[model samples]
Target: MVMAFRKKPTSVIRTKASKPKTPTNWLHLIKPMLMFLCLLFAYVMYSNWSSWLALLDKTPIRAYALTHKTQFTTNSDIRDLLSKEPVLKGYFGQDIQEIKDKFLEIPWIKDVAVRKVYPDRISLTLVEHRPTAIWNQTRFVSAQGVVFDLPKERFNADGLPELYGPDSEAKKVLEAWYKIQKDLESRNLVLKSVAMDIRGSWTITLNNHVELRLGRGDWLPKIDRFVTIFPEIEIPDGKRLSYVDLRYEHGAAVGFISQ
Candidate 1:
């Protein structure tokens, strides 16, 4: 399913964020230290050729300390990704950006930070994603408007609105839902779902099993008209509200069904 970021800085975005919880990635925590020690060896080798051969066994890579808030990403997920990296010792102090670019390949990873330390060590920091809503019934969007996909079972989709729209219009569709939701609340209506068809028309289902055909092009005004007229609608005995066609230039056509 799709996920959106929530409450993350512009530089870091999204997850429920369906974020990572633990394991293997902590190796990434140690990867920098190893990189630093390896680079230090390379530098010493170049300067004095004699000391390089003496202390080759003391790998700077120490034990790792892992930190994660969720379990959306697993140990194997990270292990498999890191296995593909060219041995870190191959290039003299391996290109920092290149190391970062490699891990960024994981779908769940939002960003990676790399730097060199004073005593021949490397440091890597992995950024986490925060998920806000599910999109197109399959992906999630972050608070920062980032759209990415994750499996349905990986997150808690209990209360998020199922928003449907063209991939390019994800942000627009999400924003529209928020406005519609606020209008719905003022009416004390519970929203079941919101869908925006390929042509950009909008439809919403309510908890009462009533449908609102909001029509095409910006439905907020149409919904406002609905809020005003809804309470005044008369059921005319033994009938229940079925739908309201709100596409009119003025007013709306209300439909009813036999109860």
Candidate 2:
């Protein structure tokens, strides 16, 4: 006998429908509001700028206090010097940089400290340059080899040796003078002046008023040779040492002043 089984009904499938996604609102980026704060701050500063300036103007500087560690810059001198500046023009609106530049214009001033004394005063502290020599008979040289002009006339040589050179060669001249001076002083000789001519030839004058011509090249060796022979060299009792030309390769030729 043939037997056939009947199929059971298929089970139904079911699932819940998914909700649609909404588009992102990019305008909501102001949630932290940082950009808004920046805009507000800029607006306030722009609107109140002139008012702040006026307020600062009302508090004009009435007095000045100056402190300095220097011999040439006295409190009174600084007072008289800076009084002419517009530093006291307005409390904060006036040019502080201009005042500083004016202070630096003084040949002796090396550095400066500036501050405002709250209610009515401007205060400054200064450092002065240590002068090494006088340059070209008109300007002063600092120990660091900078050349600057003095505001007042220095008629007195003040015993500082004079250095002469082209404006661009001041530092080179100073270095040469220092080295030459040290070597001469080692031999108990006084170096009074050192000069570099336009042709780049160098000459040094001793305290005895004798000049040494070390022309156009390395001069230290020539200086050494001269100082070595200086003490024992025999000079006629009546003739004074005038000049020694060290330009030659083999030896130096001594010269005497015309009788």
Candidate 3:
């Protein structure tokens, strides 16, 4: 039975095929890490630069120079001003705008330009106010109608025409003065001073020491009449005209100087 028996058919075992192992791309793996390192290095450099700048700011200003546009302001004045603020910050760290504002606070300075130079130096360009007339007793007025005052010793107001008025009316008074002066010149009269009282009353002092009183009415007409009649007015020998009152409607009242 064993010799002639057919062998049972054996089932074949099949194994799955293995996939190929691909090599890793080294460049792709290292690129992101390299980028991160570069970014970190740049940040560190920027931080160091900021720290250097901060340290430089702590260094004090070593030298300062001023350029004056006019002789109205003196070097001593500028030095005195600087002396008050002895410890100006470093040139690179200074607040230029703040320095300009402080310079403008000086009565004689009208405009100021501040600059920081290298190696701890600062330069200032100063434009001073030119006095065109004496405003009241303590102030000065410029041709541009700027009113300012400096120390009494810094300026000489001897020859300047004295102007008096409310602070708010400075520009108006200055404009009126120019017109009045031109009109008065045609009559051979020189205007020495002008004043406006709180009541808005106007008065002018001539070079010959005569005063003209122009009230709050229409002063233009009054001024015209005076200019027309001024040349014809007679003065006695050894006596000058003292004052002319122009507040009237038609004509003005003239008074002679008593001998």
Candidate 4:
């Protein structure tokens, strides 16, 4: 065997070449996926909540609960007026403006404020017209110079001044009356009534039963002139001043009560 046994050839095994693997970061992908799922869940919840709220708004139980919880307080006249209206209609469907219009239809209501409280209530505030004087014995003149009428039994007109004039001349007559009243008040005189006849002639009755006739043109100057000379006029001892006619150009005609 030591003699050269013809060296036997050894066979080498062959293997396939493998490619390099790239590392994958699962944390980044998982973070974005979790964020997307959370967003989707939140959107679904919000949509459901919105739908529930809308349904609640139209529910009859909600409207009934609000109706029972509503509170209203006003004068008897306003209350009576409100009683004629369909005020208890479905609360959610009730028109606030319609309520306000109904309130304004009342003759005495000047302005109305309506408010709706959340989840169940309504509030109303009413401003009533204040009558300053009686107009033509049928209507009333408000402090803002508006003419309106109401039930005679609703208000006391005992001490108010009686202002008579054509319907178109109400404001003018009121202004003149106010001016004359202010002027006469400076002389310790009280005006009981003011009247403007169909001929546009002005007349005033005093608290002392004295009547003053002021013809149409430039009566203010005559009134001023009379105010200036009133204190200087002298009456007979047994007589009292009864009437004054200021229709003259320069002077007034005075009448006296016979004792």
Candidate maximizing TM-score: 3
Choose 1 or 4, whichever is better by TM-score.
Answer: 1
* Model 1 quality (TM-score): 0.62
Q: Model-by-model lDDT, in order?
A: 0.72, 0.78, 0.80, 0.74
At residue 236, candidate 1 shows an lDDT of 76
lDDT of 2: 0.78
Candidate 2 on 41-149: residue-level lDDT in tens? 9999899875677576766666877664556776677777677745466565555676788788776778887787666677888887666788888788877878876
Ranking by lDDT: 3, 2, 4, 1
How many pairs of residues collide in model 2? 0
How are the candidates ranked when ordered by TM-score, highest leading? 3, 2, 1, 4
The estimated TM-scores of all candidates read 0.62, 0.70, 0.72, 0.59
Return the lDDT, model 2, position 67: 67
Name the runs in model 2 displaced over 4 angstroms.
Answer: 1-41, 44-53, 74-77, 80-87, 90-95, 151-157, 186-188, 224-239
Candidate number of the best lDDT? 3
lDDT tens digits, residues 120-225, model 4?
5567766777888899898898777678887787678999988998877777788878888988898778998888988999988888877888888766787776
lDDT of 1 by residue, 1-259 (tens): 8998689566655565567866667787899999999999888768965344335434432222234443566666655654564644322334567667776776656887766443345565667566677876778876665678777787888888777777677777778778888888987888877778888788898878788999887677887888899999998788999999998999989899998
Clashing pairs in 3: none
- Cα error, residue 120 of model 4, in Å, equals 4.9
Query: What total of clashing residue pairs does each candidate reach?
Result: 28, 0, 0, 0
